[model samples]
Target: MKTLGIDIGSSSIKVAVFDAANGSCLASTQMPTDEMIINSPQKGWAEQDPNTWWSYFVDAAKQLSALVNMEDIKAIGITYQMHGLVAVDGNGSVVRPSIIWCDSRAVSFGNRALEKIGVEKCLQHHLNSPGNFTASKIAWVKENEPELFSRIRKIMLPGDYIAYKLSGDITTTAQGLSEGILWDFKEERVSEFILNHYGLNKEILARQVPCFGHQLELNSEAAIILGMKEGTPITYRSGDQPNNAFSLNVLTPGEIAATAGTSGVVYGVSSSIAYDPQSRVNTFMHVNHTTKDPHLGVMLCINGTGILNSWLRRNATKGLSYIQMNELASQVPAGSQGLTILPFGNGAERVLGNRDLGAHMQNINFNIHSTAHMLRAAQEGIAFSMQYGVEIMKTVGVIPTVIRAGIANLFQSDLFTQTVADITGATIELYNTNGAIGAARGAALGAGYYSKSSEAFSTLKVEKVVEPSRNPLLQEAYGNWCHCLNQQLK
Candidate 1:
């Protein structure tokens, strides 16, 4: 028998079936064939219909059923984009469009909340600022859309909403609550102080469930619609980043998981109870976190990463493919011949004190520069940006002794991976796995298919390894990039 893993992401819905015994993906499919649109009702606001995610999931499930026998699926797992706010009414109907992770509409509310709640208290109790997280998004709705807020019977993260649809139960995990800055790290429960501060009632939040194990079972209606077996347990659920780390087997302290997708993220696991005072890097409970054996995942996010590369491809590379751009980048020497680019144009960066310095290209040296210089500088800038956050992450004890990433997205580029390794001074390992695959492995552990969590990773393989280089020019390039970034901030 195989276990099913469903990944709900902003771009698409992916479904996979895995053989738990050997941890092999039996079949997998991604739905809609096209990128889903993020509705921006206003500038800096991103929203998506909750029901649309369900619809796409149903479509993906139908496709998955075509590849494997529905009866062979023993359990279900779910992972989704983090920190999204989904509110449902008493009848479990969506009250409004979900305020997604990229939405910046709640910045002011989150800032005010941080000031009023005090940084020390928030950091001590929640291990993060309530900064544009799900809780702040809910607060924004409560103030601006009172009618809709009144109808909200329960609010949950994106993964919790999917679990609700699958099992007819509304529940969340402490890890989920921590992502929303609603978890009390000290008390080991939801933070009632935050709820009271936001004038929100604790009753509106979903009840807590363990991140793994038999949290719920497939409801008959959902089972019939998706051709899944009724009473099949929903065993595992997590946000995408933590799930990615688990997928990579980066469960111990000093191990880090990095991803360069539409945005960039570095999630490092540490056993120590820690928090970044400036909120430069957010901290959330890891998938395996427990009171007896605590694991905190410190996350560093760059709003711009692959998007900057995509922008370079569209505007600067003269219609070159990503592979071609990487080739051009490789031709250029380190430091891009004194040219530096800061890849922070996507939006306000939390790491940069929520400042939108925009994308900066410095020391262009127009007389000698070519497309190669620009491409190489952009990639190097992203790597330097990650190193910048890594410096701050070190403050909270999330040392990136070894960084693991999937052999996809930016890691697919040799130039980018090498630059990241050289800049961060850490060994980098790339694996041929992803969030959905990790969920499948997690389901195996949660459903007792595997005797221990480590068994699920027995088949996980390393595709490549990158080591830090002792290149003076590479070090000089990062120094130049930092100087330019400091100038922009000033």
Candidate 2:
């Protein structure tokens, strides 16, 4: 049997076909050859049309159908960019453009909620301050776009919205809700306290479902649209980070997963409930979490990571390939020769307490610094930013001695991977699998093709392992980078 996996990402929609019996990806493709447009009507605001996602999804499915037998695809699973707010009317039409993960427009509203709801109460129940999450985004709509809010019959994360499009069922999972700050960790359900505080009707929320299991079936209309058989069950759904961890088989306590794509993330699974006091690093239900076995994932996200590198490539390097950029960066020694880069330009960073400090490059000397030096500094800065968040994660008991990541994005860079390993003091394992493949294997597990999660990933193999080197210069460079970062924060 084959399984279909769809990853609804911020930049593009990805689809993959996996051989369920062998856990090998048969085919994969992405829609819109170029990155999808993220509309920003105003600074600090990001929006995307849900209809655009559906259109691209259909395009992606059509491409996938040419490479695989759609009829043989047994199950569908979805993983999406987390913390996005999608609202739909009773007829399932989008009420407004989705407020995506990187949008910082709702920061003030979230801060107000944090103050009004009381810090202790929020920390205990929600495990995070209402800081620029989906809940806050919804509240923004209600306060600013009151008419649209009144018509909203359902609120969903991006993955939930895609699943609804596929199955015509409005449902979400605990893991999805937690990413939105809607799930109450203490109560193990949607938080009525948060709903009441935001004046949001609980009815607006989608029906709750388990992360795994047959949640919905592909409807005939969607089947016809995608040239797939009707009634194929959508067996699994999760936010991208947790699904990335699941894809790597980092399911147990202390096992960690890292990803550096449009954004950077460090996700660690834990058996106990833990919260960061500052609410910098957030915790949510892992894909395999249950009331009895409660597994939580402590996550640290840096909004600016590969996007910074992409920015440099576009504005500075004049269209160099990422491989070229990596090769150029590798030429520079540690610290980028006293050049420092602070990659906080993308949006409000949670690790910086939802502050939009903007990207900064300091200590540049016209005579001494070269383009290669700038490229290396950018990579080192991104690594240091990750290490900064990892420190907060350690405070919450999710320490990582070894980190697993896919051989994609920044992990493809030897310099980038080495910097992360050396700075964070952890062994980095690179895998051949990506998010779509993970979602496919998760579909197999949820559909009962595999009786256990282990069976689903039994074929998973590590491609390479990177260990930290005892480079004395790395520590000194990190210290200088931290000093610059602290100065900016102050």
Candidate 3:
């Protein structure tokens, strides 16, 4: 038997099927994807067709089924990009392109919300300001496209949309609501305060469902289209960061999860309720959160990382592959000699209190700085950006001693991995896993295949562990990096 997990990312849709008995991946594949079109009809806006995700899911699943017995798939779970807004009409048809997680179009609405709700009240109840999250995106729709907004019957995140398509059910979890700034931590329900403040209808929210329960059963329509058995349970769903943490077994307090995908994230599990005053870092309900045993995720996002690296490869490096760029970066000495790069160019950064400080490169020398030095500077800038957020995580009492990440994207770079470890003084462990695999493992537990979390992840092992190289040169390089970051931030 197996469980299937689908992760809808900004860049690609990844699907994985995990063996229930051994908790190992049976098959996994991502489909013929162009980089998702982040349509910027206006500056600082990013939107994507919700239907495109549906198409990618079907395509990826078809490819994955060729390698495994599709009939053996017993459960389905979904992990997706967070803070996206997907509105469906009465007929369950999408009304507009999804305003995705990184979109900054809702900044004005969010700022109004902060002013009206009062910063202290929003922080106390929502654990965040209503900054470019799904709720504010909805407000933007209501004000700008009133006709489309009026026809909305349900509002869901990207993952919720996928689950609805598979199971013919419309529902969301508390964890989902929290990520959208729609959940009230104090009330333990959707925040009526935010709804009232934003003048939104509460009924637009899909019914609340358990995060790790029988969320839905496969509908005949979806089952036939996907070549799956009818009535298979869809057991789990979460935002990618929470699911990433679950995949790493970072469910308990003090466990830390870091990933450098299209964007970067440092998510740490916390037992104590905490909020950042500036709402720079966000707090969301973890997949295992409960009234009795609450676990909140303190998430610090950099909105840069691999995206910046990819940009450098495409625009700056004249079409060098990521591996080629890594090779070039490795050839440069530590600290890039005297060059520094700041990777804050991707819209408004949440870690910088939603500031839109575009990326910059400094201290360029015509004779000394080669493309190798620039490449190294870019990678170091990415690591330094993450380390900056790591400091914020420390302020909230989440001192990460060891960081866990999958061996993909930027973590695949030895220079990036070692730089992160040396700069932050945290051991880095790279896993041969990603978000969807974790969701599949989670589905196995939800389906009663595993009695304990430990059992569910018994086959999960670190592929490599990098301790902070005790090399004094690394320390000196890191000090130079911190100096560069401080100079830029000031």
Predicted structure with the largest TM-score when compared to the true one: 2
Candidate 2 colliding pairs = none
Query: Per-residue lDDT for 38-138 in model 1, tens only?
Result: 78888777888988899998998888888889778998889998999999999999999999887888888988999998988888898888888889999
Model 2 C-alpha lDDT per residue in residues 371-399, reported as the tens digit of each score = 99999999999999999999999988988
**Cα-based TM-score, every candidate:** 0.95, 0.98, 0.97
Using lDDT, rank the candidates from best to worst.
2, 1, 3
Clashes of each: 0, 0, 0
Candidate 1 lDDT trough over 10 residues, lowest sum: 29-38
lDDT of each: 0.88, 0.92, 0.88
Report the lDDT tens digits of candidate 3 across residue range 449-488.
7888888878889999999966566566657767766676
- The root-mean-square deviation over C-alpha atoms between each candidate and the true structure, in angstroms, is 1.9, 1.0, 1.6
Better of 1 and 3 by lDDT: 1
RMSD of 2: 1.0
Once fitted onto the true fold, the runs of candidate 2 whose alpha carbons sit more than 4 angstroms away are none
